[model samples]
Target: MPQPTGPATAPRAPATASSPPSAPPPFPPQSGPPPQEALAPRAPVPPAVSEATRLLCVGVHHDRAFREAVLDELYVHEERFPAPSVGIDAGRVLSHAVRARNHEVGWAGGIVGLWLLGLIVSGGLLALALLGSVGLVVARWIRGSGSADTGVGLVRRAVAFYVRWLSRLYLVYLFFAVVLAALFLGGGTFSGGSGFGPGLSDPLGFARLAAFLTLLVLAGIVACVALRRGQFARVVSEELSPSRFPHAQSDPAETTAGPRLSHLRTRLRAEQHQPLVMYEEDWPFRGFGTPFHTWSLAIELRPRGEAAPVPLDNGEILRRIVPLVEALRVPSPRKDPAAAAAVIDRLRELRLDECVFLPADGLEWRNGAPYAPDAFAAHRAAALEEGGEARRHFLRIRVGGWDEELVVTVFVRVHTQGGMLMAEFAPHVLTPVRRGYRLAEREARRHRALSWPGHIAWALVHTPSSFGDSVRTLGGWLWGELRRAFAGYAGAPAEGPSAAVRELGTDEDLSLFQEMDLDRYLKTIQDRVAGGVRTALREAGWATDEFDQKIIHVANGGVYIDSAKDSAIGIGNDNKISHTPGGKGGGKK
Candidate 1:
C-alpha cells in the first residue's frame, strides 16, 4: 500500500566508476499507468492476412498453371470411379445352339418320313440308325487328334472349304441337267417317240412321267441351293431356344471378387453432394476413314468482379472468329514439290475452279438464311426451351486449295446469362480421290448384288466371309450417313465423298488415292486451324482451355478418353503428344 502511493517507481541506481552515467529517466518512465501505446487498446491489429484470395484469383485467362491445375482436378475426379465391364460369349453359345437345332430338325424330318412310309417299327429303327450315323460323323469331325494340330486341322478345314464350293458347283450342274432334259424330252416328243420310258407303248403316260421327273429335279435343285447358302444356318443361329442354351455361366473368381453394387451405391452416395461437370467431346468434321487431327479450345466466362460482360450476339462472335479462320492456311507446298504438283494436276483434271484448292488464303462467309419463327417454335416444341434469352447464328466458310476444298461451318449461340457464348467451329475438308466416281459405281453395283436374295444365298453358302464383310461395310456406311445428318444439323459440315469428285474420278484413280497417306496432309491443315483459333481467343482477352478436347475416331465410332493417363488431354495432330517444339499439342490449352 505504501509503495502504491508513489506508483511503484523504480529506485535510482548509484553511478559506477567504470560505467558512464545513465540519462535521466523520462517523466512517465516505468511507473504509474502503462504507456499510451501499451494501454490504449493497441490499435486493433489487422487480422492475419491470407494468400487464398491471391491463389484463387489466378484465373485461367492468362495463367497456364491454373489451366493445368483445373484439368488435373477434372481428370482425377473422373478416374476415381471404375467403369463397368460387359462380357459376352456370343460365338461359343451361338455355335452350340445351331448344332443342337440342326439335330432337332433332322430328328423331326426322320419322324415325318417314317409316318409317311407307314412302317412304324422298322422305319423308326432306320431313322434311329440314320441319326446315330450322322452323330458319329459329327463326333469324328470334332474329335481329330490333337497331335495333328496343324496338319489334320488344315485338311479338315480344306474339306469344309471344298464342300462349300462343291455345293455352289452343284447349282451349275442342276442348271445343265434341266437344259438337257428339256432338249431331249421336247425333241423326242415332237419326233413321236416316248420321251423317257418304254418306246411308244403309252406315249402320253411316258411324257407325263418325264414332265413329273423334271419338276421333281427342279425342286430338288432349288432346295439344294437354299441349303448350301447357309440360310438354314443363319435362321438356326438366330432363333436359338433359351431353354436349350441358357446364358453363359459366370466365372467363380469374378463372382467372388468383382465390385459389389453396394460399394458403388456407397461411393455414389458419398459423391452426390459434390459438384460434377459432364459433357461429351465430338470428333471434328472429317470424311470416313480420314484421320481425326483437330483439337478445340473451350472457354467459360462468368461475371467479373461486380460487373457483367456485355452480352455478345452471333454476328459479334462471327466477326471475332473470322480472322482466326483466315489465319489457318494450309502449309506451303514448297516443302514437297512433287506431292504438290501431283495434287495440282489431279485438281486440274477434275476441272475444279482455281479458288477451290487447298492452302486457301481466306474463307468466303455465307450467312445461312434464318429459319421462320414458326419453324423454330415447332422444333422447340418437343424439347425444353432455354430459359435465358438466346439466339443462334450460322456462318459457312468455304476455303479451297491444294486439290481440296474445306467447308467450315461456325455455329455461335449466345446467351444473356453471364454473357455466355458458345462457338462451335466445324471444318470439313473434301479431297479428290483419283477414281472416286468409279469406286462409288463399283460399290453401288456390289451393294445391289448383295441385296438380291439369290446372291445373298450364294454368298452365305459358298463365301460366308465375303457375305459378312459386305454386310459390315454397308451397315457402316448407313451408320456414318446417319451420324453425318445429325451432326450437320448441329452445325457440323456434312461428310462423305464429294459429289463433284465422285462424278468425275475413275476407279483406278480412287484406288490410288485410297492408298495415299492423306492423313499427313489433313493433319497439317488441322493443326494450323486449331492454333489460329487459340491465338485469336487469347489475344481477345478470352481464356482458352481444352478440357473438352477429347480424342475420338469418327470412323471407329465414339470418343476414347483414357482416364489413367489422361490421353485425351494433350492429343495433337498425330492423335498424341508432339515432342517437337512448335508442334501441335492439344491446341495449347
Candidate 2:
C-alpha cells in the first residue's frame, strides 16, 4: 500500500482553504507506464531460500515428482523480490526436503550409470546412439530450432533445450536396452560365458544380463524415492491452507521426513527463536513484507522561536504517533457466520510486526556456549528505544487479502539524527499466487474421479518432460552444492535468512483493482502518519508551513484531477493480469 507522496520537489505554494486551485494534474497515475522502481534490479535471493520456494512450487504445480517447476509462473515476474518471511519456516522446510532431494539425486546418478552400461552392450550401444541423435533432431523440430539472435543460444538456452530431452531419450534407451537383453537371454549363462545353458556363448550377453538386473533395481528405487516427495507436498499443504497461505508452524518430530532431517529441522527451529548473528545479510527488510513503494521526508527539528528542542529518540517519536496509528484496528467479529468469518479473516490479515536488524561480526562467538543474554537484550533495546545508522528498527504492517493471495504491506521507520528528523513510509504489495500453484490444493480436496480421457491425455503429453525433470533437477542441485562448497571454503557462505514463498508464485503484474486497493491502503496509512507527525511538530512549537506544503503535493502526486494541467503522458490503461477483487468495505479487502 503506497501513495505518491514525500518531500515535494514542486515549487507550487501551499493552498489555503479559502481559495484552492481549480485543478491539478494527477502527478503519478496508475494507468501510466510502470514505475521506475519496477525496472530496478531484483533483490538477490539467498540460495537456500530460493531453493525452498522452488520445491514448494514444484509440489503445488507438479504432483508426480519433486523437481523445480521452471518458468511456470511466467507472469509472476514482479513479486519475486525477496521480502521478509511471513508464516513459513525456511530452515525447517529445507531440512525436511534435503533427504528427499538426495534420494532423487541418487536415482539420477543411477540413470546415468544405466546409460553407460547400455553403451557397453552390442546392439544396445548402436540403438542408443541412433535414438539419441534422432531424438535431438526430432526434438529440435518439435521444440523449434534455436536462433542465434539471443545470447548463449548455443551454450545456454539451446543447450538447455537439448538437455531437456536427454532424460526422455535415456528412458527410451533403458526400454530398448532391456529388450535387447531379453533377446540375448538364451545366448548367455550365469555360470559361464560359454554355451553352458544357452544357444550361444558371449561375454557381452552376460554383461547385458547384469545391466538389465541393475535397471530392475533402479525401478524399485524410483518408486521409493517418489514417496518422500509426496509426503513433503502433503505435509506442507495440510499446514498451509487458505488461513495460513504460506506459513505453518510444523512440528519436526511429528512430521518427520527422516531421522537426520528431523534433527536438522529441530535445530533450525531453535535457531529461529534465538540467533547468534545477522545471517541474512542481503535482506535488509528482513522479517517484513517486500518493500514496493517507499517515500522518505526529512525535516529540521529546530524550534520556531529560539527554544531548546525536546530530547527525541525513535521510541519518543513513536509515542507521539501510535495513538493515530491505532485508528485502523481489527473490529470484533460480527454475526452471520460467513460474513463474519470473511471480515475477521481480512482484519486478521492486517498484521503489525516489530523487529530489529543488528550487526554480527564484532560479537564474541563460542560454539558450545549458550547464546549470551546480553546480546539478546542489546537487540531488544535497539528495537524499542535506541536508533542508529546501523541498528535500524521498523513498524511493519501487512494486509493479506483475497484468501492471502494478494498482500499489501506498509513499513514505517522513524529516527532523529544530527538535528534532523527523518520519517519513511514504504508499502509493498505481493500480487496473487499463480493459479497453477493452487492445483495441489484442488487435487487434494476434490473427490476422486475415474481416470478420464482428458486426465490421461494430459499425462501422456507431459510424460517425456516429466521423465526428464529429475536429470535437470540433479544438475541444478549439484551446481548449487558445488557453489556453496566453494563459498564455504572461502568463508563467505550466506547465513542470515528471512524469506517468504507466496511472492515467488505471484502474477507478474497486479490487477487494475489490486492497484486501486494498493493506492487506497497507502494513502490511508500515509495520511494518518502525516497527521500524527505534524501534530508532534506543532506540539513542540516548530514551523509546520513547509511540511504542510510538501504533504499536500505528496497526497495525490500534487494533482487536482479537475484542474487545467500541462500536457503530460497519459496513464494508459493496460493491466494484463486477471484477478478477482474481494471485500468492498469494512476491511474485507
- C-alpha RMSD of candidate 2: 14.8
Instruction: For residues 1-589, write the lDDT of model 1, one tens digit per residue.
Output: 0111112234455555665666443342121222222212111111011111111111211122232332222111222211100011112211222232333344334333332232233223223223323333344445443434577777776665555455445545544554454345422333355354433334543443444444443343334333433333332222222111222133111123224323433342332211111101121111111112333333465333454445444334445555544433322346654443222211111110000001101212111211244543443332112322222223333322221211111222222234444433333223222232223333433544454576546543432122222233344434544654553333432121111111111011122332232333333334433454444445455544531242123223223322211122112324432121111111111
lDDT of 2 by residue, 24-51 (tens): 5344211111222222221222222232
- Residue 192's lDDT in candidate 1: 55
Best by TM-score: 2
Candidate 1 Cα outliers beyond 4 Å, as residue runs: 1-163, 166-296, 300-314, 323-589
Could you tell me every candidate's TM-score relative to the true structure? 0.29, 0.58
Clashes of each: 10, 11
Span of ten consecutive residues with least summed lDDT in model 2: 580-589
Position 260, candidate 1: lDDT: 35
CA lDDT, every prediction?
0.29, 0.47
Candidate 1 backbone clash number: 10
